[model samples]
Target: MSDNVYQKLMRVQSKLKAPKNQFNKFGNYSYRSCEDILEGLKPLLKEVGAILVINDEVVNIANRFYIKATASFISIDDGEKIISSELAREEEERVKFDLAQLTGSVSSYARKYALNGLFAIDDTKDSDSTNKHDKDNITSLNNENKWTNPKLTDNQIKRLYAIAHSKGVVAEKVKSQVEKQLNKKVEELTKAEYDKVCEAYENIKVANS
Candidate 1:
């Protein structure tokens, strides 16, 4: 009997070890981001003939906002896929960030944990679990713009897609073009890049009018 996709993925997951590549000065601790996990899993995924994909959706429940990130592993030879999801709430009051930034932060956090669940990555000693004082300081620093980026919200992304579709432009083509021009994935695009993409799409809509 041939091993299924889940078994093959488990084999890869057993060898995956994402090291802490970032340090928080305020917290005086090291931590791993979603990017770090993805980086570490790249070679392992290739070795196992699997592809990893991540996507996010925004949810509102009882006037509270949450970001749900879904991570999936797909077998290359067979089309079998395994998926997991995790949700993070928008810490609007705790963190002095705009709605978009809050959503992005929550999305990233959810994505990290979702991937962790899929890969069984143990985060027992991570900064979130330790260093409460440092975490508070880090939150303060984040509000001061010491570490934060402007990002697009789920609504913004949907608006962009709607504009592209209305202009008879393929949504995927526009996304690919923006990613190629900015040299980053749509999800990873910075605030400036996101604004630029939106502006370009707006221009297209205007020109066609």
Candidate 2:
């Protein structure tokens, strides 16, 4: 791929940061797969003249499988050993790390790493592009999709449950307790706001059904 494209991909990847509790959400988060990291990178891919492709191989270790993502810069020179998807795998927590990396496209934090391996993503768009794919011109398709609505995962829910049950939201301790348990920058959501989000999701489900 062109240096321009590679740079853009790196910028995008660097921006990826995993949430405290990632993936593992029920409802559309699991089945529809909307809040997808790859989907977020669609515009960047088209802009940079690169295509990100993923492949899979099975390992004989029982229920083991390997997934590889290849980011091909269409403009790369033949002799050059351009970035390959094979480099994406990390050993020693190989399964867990690879799985996290592969699914990063769906999770907020992990997507950054995925983009790093796949494209030339630059945060500073002024010098990176050839005036065709400037940052301002690139539309964020991430906002248009249904799955864009992010929610806490099962792990996060459990953490929240534990905090709420253990401390029972004593006046001064709620904030610290939540932050410690959830590992998220938590704020007290007003009952109205919380109810609204829940009701809106419920309405969405009913409408879709």
Candidate 3:
């Protein structure tokens, strides 16, 4: 019985040290970003013969939009993979930016949490005591307004992808086209924007047919 993937990953995670490289002026505290963790993990991953992959998806459940970030660690020796995911909700108020910025912010947050979960990084202190901004807005109307902008469901995303694929369009190409058209990521699209993407792909399928 060889050592499992979890044990191998724990060995690497034990050697990982992610320093707080970012400072929050509002909260007067230091923190680390997802990039910092990734950077720190690079050499450790190589040493441990593991590969780290991070991915994001937007999910809509019950009319609420959430950014789901997943981090996977794959062992190069035995091809074993371990995955962890974290989700962050999209804010509704649009305090200073548009939907794109909001989605980007949430995506970054989700990624951070996903990495934290994967590496067993201690975030209780940072999140509980230093995250004054998030704590203050925890119950804000912007955060609570779940109905302002509806999101596309998983089925809708699958349908859109299927339509695009049938028309010889790759997922990246479709996502790039949608981003260019709306100046936002496909995951950040509102319900109307998502419908437009579906319609656009439908037109392509019709043309090919």
The candidate that achieves the highest lDDT relative to the unseen native structure = 3
Model 3 off-target regions past 4 Å?
1-3, 127-209
Model 1: clashing residue pairs? none
lDDT string, candidate 2, 35-128, tens digits: 3445665665565445555433322232433233343444333322244333111222222234444344223222332344354333222121
Give residue 38's lDDT in candidate 2 (0 to 100): 59
Model 1: runs farther than 4 Å from truth? 130-209
Candidate 1 lDDT tens digits, 1-209: 55689888889888998999987664466788889999999999888888999998876655765567889999988889999887566433343466566556667777877888899987755764333221221111121224333344444566678877877778788778877787777767654556667777777734534
Q: State every prediction's TM-score relative to the real structure.
A: 0.60, 0.30, 0.60
**Each candidate: RMSD:** 17.6, 15.0, 17.5
Q: How many backbone clashes does candidate 2 have?
A: 18
Q: Over 4 Å off in model 2, which ranges?
A: 1-5, 14-35, 61-209
Over 1-209, each residue of candidate 3 has an lDDT whose tens digit, in order, gives: 65678887989888999998887664456878878889999999887778999898877766876777889999887989999887677444444446666667677777776788788898766632224323211111122433333344444576788889988898899888987878987777765566668777778634433
